[model samples]
Target chain A: MKIRKINPAGQREPPAERPIKRRATKIHYGMSEIVITIVLVILALVIIIPLVVPLLFSFKTQLEFAYHPWALPKAIRWTNFIEAWKAVRIDQGLLNTLVVCFGSIICTIPPAILAGYVFARYKSRVTEILFYAILIGYFVPVQMVLVPLYRMEVSLKMNDTLYGLFLPMAAFGIPFWTLIFRSFFKSIPREMAESASIDGAGHWRTFFSIMLPLARPATVLAIIQVFMGAWNDYLLSLILLSDQNKFTMQLRVASFLNSYGTDRMPRYAAAVIISALPTLILYLIGHRWIIKGMLSGAIKE
Target chain B: MNVFKRKAVLRTEPAKRKKKDPGRKVFVFLCVLPAILFLAVFLYYPIEETFRLSTMKTTGLSNEVFVGTDNYEKLFRDEEFLAGLRHVFSWAFWSIIIQLPLSFFIAFSLTYYSNKLTKPLQAIFYLPNVLPSAITAMLGKFVFAPNYGLIVSLGKALGWKWLASIDFLGNPDLAFWSVFAVATWAYSGFYVIYLMSRIEQIPKDLREAAELDGASMWCYARKIVLPELNYPLRILAILCTVGSLKLFDLPNMMTMGGPGNATVTLGITLYRHGFINWNYGKAAAIGVVIFVLSLVFTILQFSLGRKEDETI
Candidate 1:
């Protein structure tokens, strides 16, 4: 009877262990796994080729591009970039874009941090309503406000100026950034605030000294998102700023495309690359943070 | 008298705490005041103005005589405006049909079967998203150029003679699809990353348990993974719809909504009406329509999704 019981128990153990081993092995090198890997590689190539093609085309002359559109450049044409720079006046555009991006960031971050702290910590009916009211700003499309905004800018004599762009961009950025900041602040323990208050620090003092320092991750996330948005903005810049000299990189690139009309492929390619260089470099360095910030809104538990 | 005294003491204690922190209310107000004021001016004021302007007849931004519903009437009758609405729906439809599935596939593959190549591949997929929309538009223009474009060259190499003369952006029927294709290519990477992040959050032990139960990959994904992803997917659907309504830059840059209003989305139409034709009133009407449509669609989607959840 002992032998019989042992045999049945031992048989059950091996069966359970066998299936897990089988599953482990199947996950590692099955035919389905191989097929999925191959498919993923193909999909990766599809995405990579489009991006890399433009970069490669930027280095070739128009003649080389026309003759061998798929091949790498035989001789690099560095002047393509120079001509593109002159044609688009990208130096001016880049400077304007940088100013707008940084200025808007400066305008947006502090207000967001302050407002977010208040909304996150303070509990009241009025504050709750006000928080939702601010969130309504997120749903308002830029299209809905473009006409009136243009009029407002013109009447205020803010049209065609970088500061003009900065104000609206910063204003529009507030709702989303505030939401991110509020969520981050909420994650901190209430005791932190209570201790500060007990130690004789006021709201602003505690916020500036302690809370703000703890909010580095959210701040980094906000800065990256806001900078990218301001940098890549095309519609507002196009409508609000009429002056050729004040065009952002996107606006300059659009007008350049219209005038260049696809004839100067190499030059246009170079212009595209140059316009995207700053954001691309930033993205390469801070992609993880950017992705985290972006997914925060959708993935909140 | 004793019960009354106890109640009095309780009320007084809380009142005393409130009196001690009287500065907190003022401080909160000061903290939120700037953002509230800024949003009120730039965002809320303009939205209110757009609604007000939509009801009036105006040559430009000023001299509004309220001709109620005239602009809305004109908008419905306008062929370009109607076409713009149709194009936006189609764009949204195609985005849901094409972009969502493709992104899900790529994201699922990367998350489930991660290898050394996953990081580099993820970066490459997201490259288009980081690039300026103008550059993305330009790349589309290059790829579809009839003369020396990659598509044409590849077609020739494959001996597909019909593609040599195809003007993808210039043709009316093709212009809309071409812009849609470019948008899908440019934006899918963003969704891939989004879904991948969500998928990554699923507990490894659960997945292992499913595997140990001898669950097929499809069974595991369908039974376990997809249910967890339902909420994020719903959010994604709403974003995709709203985003499609706001499609402007690519169509504006590539075809300029050309070949007879083929690719003109609501945003492009509003832009042209306001800035190009200087018809502020008509533009405002279109803006109202876009807003209403987006709001209605979001409500409908939520209701529909809720019903599905209830049934499940």
Candidate 2:
């Protein structure tokens, strides 16, 4: 057996004609790689310490927290959670948050899907104008409407009611959800809709039977985004629901801080953790979908 | 045979399409009407009401006399409102100058120098984003508490006696920066994920080719990565601007815009005027200003983005 070689002019030469030498490329880990990795590790630690330290403080007694603020608890005090839970009315807040989240989701999703489906499938001058009209809703800052909304709520006798918050929350949620659902619906092949029409299915029938079932991912994305928005909302709940009994988790935590004072560091820490736990759990499970939704929403034209 | 048959079918389809169904059009309109009505009631109506209120003087909710631009003039002259605007600009400055770069660096490092630990590290970095802003603000308050705060303890451990009793949130000079720091901590993770997605879109082969040509990492980043990220960076810049202008929750929760309104933002000012002071007209004026400012910025961003696209 003989090895072949190529000449500079691109002609093949016989093995007997000449011998060639090849240099092996070596891969090495240099100082730059080490420096970059170390820098990244430091950055990661900076982000993690802030999140984890508060949890550790939550387990300590007030004295323990004061004495060794940076140390892990020598003995975990589960009573801190109980104390914080009662002081902050975590049970009521949690219940209100759940109700608001569910109400907003139920109110927002169906209308958003219907509107999105229509926008995606139907084309006309009216639909185009209506679509842009709704898109403008995306840029309207909540501050611009807060005063009027308050007045409206007062006049309508909807202030301090869960349903009052639900209506506006669902309304604010529509623009984003409609945009997401519209894009998702547009991605579905038109052939499905045409075939459904050929089969004599009405618009609602086609949407319910074909489009909604295929929009599972978008639905999940919408639910997660809207649930987090409504659950974590602070300013709206603060202004709208002044009744302590109707307070959401965010308002409860804020009120706890104001009333409980800063001396009770451990209890405050516990309250903070409890307030954030649901969102944390949701993110841990559905982070991929959350990131996907965020990126798609941001980058989409 | 298939082509001939499709031609015959295509010729007959247009004749059948001549009969348009008004019922289908009406059904489509009905499907979209609910959303339109919701927006009109909840969104557009309030905006129009804000504009109307801004032009009037309200004693209570009912008594209104058109005052022309008096409220707007008062907004510019009001010291606290001016301070709120200044603080928001400062927040935007820090966000654009510091937070954006920090997030970009983390994202770039994670993508280019990733190893087995990268995935877990990304999740950890983004942990703050998943938590409630209110919780994060509370956590920030605890971290900067005068006596037992993590910062105070760290300073004491490092033999810095001056930090032993420094009040971060109570000092007028330090309150705004303190709240700004917490805002950065809570939200920078969002941008990290955003920039990471953009960086991921850059072609892998391009980077590899540059490396094979003996281009240094700095050269590769400057020549290939930065240019590729141009559009997302622009979008992120606009988002950062609009988002900072709307800053409310963290400052409201952490400091209540306290220490003499040091951390007050436009949103906080609106909240104060309407809810606390019961000056609906003044608050409506502030609301109008914020809306106009955000709209102007958005329009500028779009036009700038279009120009860049054309130039490229």
True-vs-predicted CA distance for residue B72, candidate 2, Å: 0.7
- Candidate 2 residues B1-312, lDDT tens each? 999999999997885465336567877888888888889988999999999999988887689999999999999999889998998887887898988888988898888877897787778777788677778887888788777677877887677989877899999999988888887888888889888988987879998788667577778878998888887777778888888788899998888899888888999999999999999999999999898888877776767667665322
Which 10 consecutive positions of candidate 1 chain B have the poorest summed lDDT?
A: B303-312
User: Would you give the TM-score of chain B in model 2?
Assistant: 0.91
Please give the C-alpha DockQ score of model 1: 0.57
Query: Whole-model lDDT for model 2 versus the true structure?
Result: 0.82
The Cα local distance difference test for each model comes to: 0.82, 0.82
Report lDDT (Cα) of residue B248, candidate 1.
Answer: 88
Q: Name the runs in model 1 displaced over 4 angstroms.
A: A1-29, A55-65, A68-74, B1-15, B157-159, B297-312
DockQ comparisons of all candidates to the true complex: 0.57, 0.55
What is the lDDT, from 0 to 100, of the residue A43 in candidate 1? 76
Q: Estimated TM-score per prediction? A: 0.91, 0.90
* Leading candidate by lDDT: 1
Q: Model 2, A239-301: lDDT tens per residue?
A: 899998898878888888788766777887787777667777888897777776666656652
Model 2: residues with Cα > 4 Å off, grouped in runs? A1-30, A70-74, B1-20, B301-312
Best by DockQ: 1
